[model samples]
Target: MKKHLLLLSAAAAALLAEEATLAPVSVVATGVEESVVEQPEAIAIKEKPEIELDQVVFQKDLFNSLPGVRIEQTGSVFGHMTAIRMPINTGPYYLFMQDGIPVQSSGFFNHNGLAYTTFGTAESVEVLKGAGTALYGSDAVAAVIDVHSTPAPSEKRTFLFKGTGGMYGYGSGLLEASGPAGEEGGYFANVHYLHSDGWRDHTQADRLEANGRYDLAIGDANALKIILNASKTEAQQADSFNDYANITDRSKAASDDPNYFKALEYVDVKRKFDYARLSLEWSNFSFENLDIVTTPYLRYNRNRYIATWQPNLPANDNELTTLGLLQRNTYQADWGRVIFGFDTEYTRSSLTYDQKFDIQTSGWSAAYYQAGTIYDYDVDYFAIAPYAHLEWNMSDKVVFSAGLRYDYNKFDYTNNLEDDSYYYALTSKGQKAIYYRPGDRTDSFNHVSPKASLSFMPDATTNLYIRYANGFRIPQASRLYSMKAGYETVTLDPETSDTYEIGLKKFFARHTFVDLAAYYMNIDDTITRYKNDNGDYYYANGGSSIHEGVEVGAGYAFNPSWRFKIAYAYGYHRYDNDPKYGDNEMAQAPNHTGNIRLFWTPWQFPGFELMAEYIYVGSWWFDDDHEAGKYKGYQLGNLKASYRYDDHLKLFAKIDNVTDNEYAVMARYAYGKTDYTPGDPALAYLGVEYRW
Candidate 1:
């Protein structure tokens, strides 16, 4: 690692000298007003024209410009999946932000909740590469993506409408309005709805979301901003089946008996989320050079899931709800800035499973229903966390950041039934009822996480940085609720990882750019699920593991009419103990992934644009069996065209998965099953927008 860092530093130095001493023309464009240069490497020297805010707002165009970022659809309108080819999930890789505020759920593996933001309503999406947990939180182990909404103009009220429809009963509509509400106030509101029938059988999803914000100038130096957001999503379950031959044929009937496939399962899921925030800003406080800002906010979220596989029994329901309050204050000084914040989150979750078995299934043919059967079990959980982040500019050429967080969580479980199910109590032949006593269990724990980063600029053509962070994930309620008879309660240890990273950013001429990063992480007590001899599944600590990777992205403009962009990521993971499973890498994580895109604007039509892009994902493991083989690699292509009519009206069309290729973003097999499955089907859409 030391040698690699040294080599990178030497290469950056050589590039800086050649570009600065030999090149006579100015290649770099410094447009970010607040961006401070710390070291010689911090300069962004480029030959291509500067990328303004407007150019980075659109998806097709933006993806074409970023180096290693790959944006693909997960085959559903209400949900999309992004993979960084790293350890982190896509939802956390990109920070979801409304305006400038962060929007995220406060639980592990729930990063998918960021989908609450309606993509149709976004004005711009920003993708920052590399780990960002130092600035965000534990979940940002890969990158930070920020989505910004349009801001209200000062002149007059503006109204915008957009709608899209296409094959497979796919459609979406959005309405937005913004303008000056009064002499010192402005407001913006957006509402959107999306639906898709989905390509696979029994796979459908829909979502409705809305957001509104108001800004008020309280006085000459003070301003207040308020925001409200709400969203609801529901979908039919689409678990994979293991009839390998039938599925491989692609002609199997949708109504085929699912019992033939041991892994076949289905579920119905719904989620609701809402949040509000208020902020106050005082500029020129005490002195014209000083500024102060304070913000306080509240958030709420609820999620519920039900499985329909066991139709004879009541549905299994899992619900989680949370309420939180947060306050932050920032003071700007001449040399640097100080930011202090405090937040409290209270979350509660309920898990219930109702069990029932038919007399025939239980081998009690003489009885109408199995006697002494356990009816229901419930589990409740609570958690709270507090955090703080600080940034300091030690000098004109260097900056530093540090953060700390503490979390506390508690869980409890109870059985509502007085008797054990005959199925569980009876011998292998089911000749008698099993008798057991109802009971309860509880557990709690506390954890602290810390992060640090340093940014340095050696010259106007380069930017260099290094970061370190500690992340932790608490065990889920499902892990505890499925315990077997011998254990009173499942004892879970927190999973933790320590990450280290270094990166360099550079620009050649104004139109060409490159960003590269390398990272390594050590994970302890990694949580993994396993099945016992009786077929009951539970979570267990997987000892230790190591993950390391490199990511690189570059963009270049061939000429005024055309440009090219490419990005690639390579990663490797391995367990450190137990020689057998040690060779098995993490699931769903490919060692190689990348994307390439081309953007064109014909000289004859300046208002019209065209784009084509391709994304590739390498083979990956589905489970811990190193000999189970691997899921084959796959590629996807996309095409987009757009025309602008003045500044207020624009039309666009996009065709995704142009080859109509069948692939899976993630694949899993359980209950002693095997088979690689396809993900979502091909999709296409066309839309128009009218903006004032």
Candidate 2:
């Protein structure tokens, strides 16, 4: 292979680290300039590392060397899930943001959606690939993740604390504070705590999180801000959702009956989340051409579960509440730059599912006591979107853009049942069971999304582009009150997509850098969940799909400390015109995935640093008819280090799965065998931090 590509180009020659110099500026494709944007979609960023490590832990290390990201967890503590070139750990095609709004509360609280995000209270994390409905509308189809926090430091006044302990009895703590909350204002605060006893066996976990912020400087153009956050959790993952093929010790655990709950806090997993936000700003407002931003927000969530196969059923409650309004303005003429926005949201959801009575062993779910509440519901949702964006600059090597967004969604469902029966004894030994009544519904949908792009820099480190976008997704609320009231869940429709992209970026001679993107998507009406002819389970529109992908990334710097990075992604999904998964290849889709990283800092190292990583995942198909003993590839290896002394200490360490590779971070194929979820073996941790 050309001498392995010249020994991988002499091992990615020239690795830099002055915080990996150059290439670090994003405003998420244009929310109106915070500088450095060349946009054409497909952006991924994760900054904050230049020897600042306390050894953060998984959420997949916040995608180190980002590019076609990946995040999956189950070794313990917060089981996150994500995959970017589509499918593995999927859910409404991704879209979870925090500083750019949309943080859960999108069309019926997706299961495991963003798993109570906060990824350690962010401070940079932005990702966007193809199709984003010209500035977010609907579920943003293929990608969007924004989480930014940590800003409220201004020169003086500061304090931080950190703590850590390792080896299956792990512990963590963090506390922070930042200066002035007045007098030209500033403010920040954080609190975090976590506990684990995991590596397997009835895993144990605990968490508490907190956040507070305030900033003000209302003159000289105005400003004001406020934020608050809270979190709580208690976890235990008994061999994950049960059924692990006769269990040969894949971390033991297979539902310990816990004497069938009824107390002890419902005997297992519980979680809660809360958030509040407010902002007001001007900074120009009509005078210097215009600049305005406004925000009003509120969020809340709650979860409970205790019956991973109905072990006597009786705990399954979920709730959500949301409120929002976001407004924007940025207008700077010269026949170009313009942006206008309006987004409003309101959501309320509550669900309950609990039932258990009689029967003796039929197999998984139904064989014991009583626990009422068969099915209950409450849903209320409303959404609004209005947007516009533009960028011209047609010379100097062209640059053109356009965007438009319009979305309206409505739903109001109330089912507090007056009669319900949806029980199925071990899958059809009771001749199936499906019955329901308890109406009152209203649904709505509207969409209009568009976008265009063109860019060709030709100079200043290269650039090239082509793009088109449109996205949509709506129909959830658990696929609409679990259907049964005018089939097709009230005229199913909303699950749309249209994307086309091409990209290139370069920076070569300054210690290397490169990125590439390619995409094609067409999706429509795709909202699956089959089985009809009286086999129960419904929710239609199921058809059409075609997705293509290619993503690449590279980085090199062998200067102020060696560095190297690599990324790859490849996908080719099918199933166009589905009536039952035609052409297959779209369930857990993963044609290829990649990663590589190496960084060091020796050469009179002044603060020490090192990192090593390798990850790859390929081969997938867990259904949608591409079945054949189902596969689900895997690979991983990790190591990290950091040291700092004098400057208020900092020390870190990590070693994970370093060759302990046992695989199976996830897998499937039910009823006739095949199940896995064992991942996590060689582990280690160390930490310290202090600042002033």
What C-alpha lDDT values do all the predictions have? 0.53, 0.67
RMSD of each: 8.9, 23.4
Model 2: per-residue lDDT, tens digit, 1-692? 01111111112212222222455566666565332336677787766562244265556677534777777765334656677766765467777776677767668645344556556656677788767745687767778877666554443577889888888898888988877654566667888888887776656777776777666655556556676666666676554433444233444453333442333344454333334444333233435767777777888777665544333444567777788878888777776777888888888888887654433333333334334665688888988888888888888778898889888989888888763334333333344333344466788888888898898987756678888888888776767666553353346788889899898887664346888889988878887766555434456887878888889988888786887878888887877869887767776677888888788878786788888888888878766665644565877888888878769888888888688766666676533334466667788988888988
lDDT of 2: 0.67
Candidate that scores best on TM-score: 1
TM-score of 2: 0.33
What does the lDDT read for residue 635 in candidate 1?
80
For candidate 1, the lDDT comes to 0.53
Identify the runs in model 1 with alpha carbons over 4 angstroms from their true place: 1-111, 126-154, 243-294, 307-316, 333-335, 354-395, 408-442, 480-487, 508-511, 578-580, 675-677
Per-residue lDDT of candidate 1, residues 1-692 (tens digit): 01112111224434554555422221111111132222211121212122221122113333433444444332222334455434323323344544444454434234444455544455444554443442344344444555444443334677888778776777888888877777666777888887877666555667777777776655455656666766677755444444545444553233233431222332233222333333332222333543444444444444443332222222344455445444444455666655455445444554444443333222112222242334345555555556655667787767777777676767666766553322353345455432233356676666787877788866565668887777766665555544445444347676677778887877675447776778787767766666666544445787777778887777798997898777777888767683336756866677888777787878889677787878887887766665466777778887777777778887777777788776655554444555344544456778887987
**Residue 331 of model 2, lDDT score:** 75
